[model samples]
Target: MVDTTTTTASPGSRLLGLTTLVGLAGLILFAFVLTEPDVRLHPTTGEEFGQFDAVRLLYLHVPMAVLTYAAFLTCAVASAGYLLKRRPWWDVTAHASAEVGTVFCGLVLVTGSIWGRPVWNTWWEWGDVRLMTTLVLFLLFTGYLALRRTPAEPQRQARRAAIVALVAVLDIPLINRSVEWWENRTLHQQSTLAELKIEDLTLFTLMLGLVVFGLVFAWLMLHRFRVGWLEHAQAGHEVALAIAERHAEMETLDVDAAIGRTGGAR
Candidate 1:
């Protein structure tokens, strides 16, 4: 028997471990130090917006949304690459990124809703273009993932999934620009990073959050890609084993027929 198991970590896994540690430390600093309570005036009302503590959620919420977009963009690029290059690795990468993107997109929606409850006095606004478009974006990617799971030949499944990924990405721009495209219809505020008035500490914390989430996204994608590779490898191995077993069985049947024919001749 082969010694298939080993206690060694790959370079990629080591890098991901280090990143996870650093990201956790940064998030801790973000929670304890950088996110100290502070007040800001409402952009439109010219009145006090007392969400000093609640606004801390913005650090996570904004970064999660950015990471979600990053993952989907990665998926789209990988899908395009697979279509051009016909490499299995590209298809695997696209599938992994889409899965990660879906999870992060869900996080964005959850955090946004939590923030909205107190700030907007509503958990959701059906008519809000940004919110509604983001929901649609999430659903589209979910459908992309489901399409990947449909039973088909490996190449056919990959081709179908790549197409879905490409189509799903069309919604990304719409979700991103929905606020600007329908400015009056959205309750969501335009990006505060565009304004010069945001406090330095808040911006710093948000940047930290982005860094942490980016690292986390990288870590997840790496692991997911490896798992996909392993699954592909195992599938090929199974097919090889099945072919070999069938060949052995045919040889046995051939020998049995030869023995019976020899006996008849005698």
Candidate 2:
């Protein structure tokens, strides 16, 4: 009874986790083992051109990047709800999504760097507008998380975090459009799915990766939200307990003083 929210597990979460695990395994096999390497002979130069073995990274990097966008957008929506309704559930959802989104954003950057090493001949390119924008987005949410930790009233903290999250989400559109807008300045390839550049097993594997990663995002968000809510509840319980204890101490002190006066008078 003292600890009502002890575990972050439910039957639904366990099933989703299993499904995500299976999907991940299937995606890896399709992307890395069954799918052909992206090797193509240049028509004019008669030279091999493509990501080759490095193309395998496309499945993970691209899916994570998309899910990162989804996660942040979810955060933004929840933050807006928190500001409008001043509800604890909204605030908890916003915080949970931002934390999960930041992690996914970090993975996107790392995977992009690894993928770039072979395709772009560099681990990172400062001038790449997409990369820079994504980094800024990551840092912004990270700052949002840090701001939540600063000592303040709970309502005040939640309000500020909500506002910061709403503002930080603006970078997502810029990151998405950077490749097209800054065609010359950025080294990012245009959207392959949009252009229908990928075909057959490669396309299927990429889509599978999206589904698998989406499941991953859901699983993480569900657990994190539950944990955050539980922490919030625990804090409230502790405050109430402290107040009750103080009242009990005051009552005990009053009783002791009354007894002493009566005995002395007698």
Candidate 3:
């Protein structure tokens, strides 16, 4: 029989979908503003009152990093739920969030590497605290994915992965404080927009846009989890059908043997 239960969305899932769409729209608007080359630097002074290129990474990178942290937080919450309540949905959420978080973390590392290459003259640096800790965070989540693939019962798998997820959350604060941990001369200059200028206000708005985008990312995770559950349910249905067909075949063989014996005896 088909498992219909797994195919449905959670209560109020539509709200999540709506929130994601709104966030995506905001991200697109911010992206357009960030991409315009019209925002340029002074020809002589070489200083840009409105230069947008170097800061463009802010439009994508900061939000992604923030989202990565958010995803892990979601995983931690879901894992906690699984541990305390043992609900299968919580396990699914934990796995889903972890997978999504890992993807964003990868993006953060790549984008940061690109930004560093232009500003720092090196694509990779061991001394950069933010870069190093970010890489470590990526690997830690990658490890969580590997942990998920390991063999064990369902609850056992969830529990083990939950512990890993919690441990990994510690890395978030570490990554945030990495700049303080190591002294680096090549570090990207801090955001100039923090001075409360008009452009800075726009950057603040852009940051809000990024937050919206992050929510969309979270929505995507929940959707992906739903798809996983649907596939699992379909597989279970196929197994059930196979078992039923095999039983029917055995019954047919038994009936045939009985008829032959009766006919021969008669």
Predicted structure with the largest TM-score when compared to the true one: 2
Best-to-worst ranking by lDDT: 2, 1, 3
The C-alpha TM-scores of every prediction are 0.87, 0.93, 0.72
Off by over 4 Å in 1: 1-11, 41-48, 250-256, 259-266
Note the Cα lDDT for every prediction shown.
0.86, 0.92, 0.76
Shift of residue 147 alpha carbon in model 3, Å: 2.1
Tens-digit lDDT string for candidate 3 (73-117): 999999889889988788888999999999989988888888777
Candidate 1 on 38-86: residue-level lDDT in tens?
5768899888767667687888888899999999999999999999999
Candidate 3 residues lying further than 4 Å off, grouped into runs, are 4-29, 32-52, 181-198, 231-266
Candidate 2 structure, TM-score to reference: 0.93
By lDDT, the best candidate is 2
What value does the lDDT take at residue 211 in candidate 2?
95
Clashes of each: 0, 0, 0
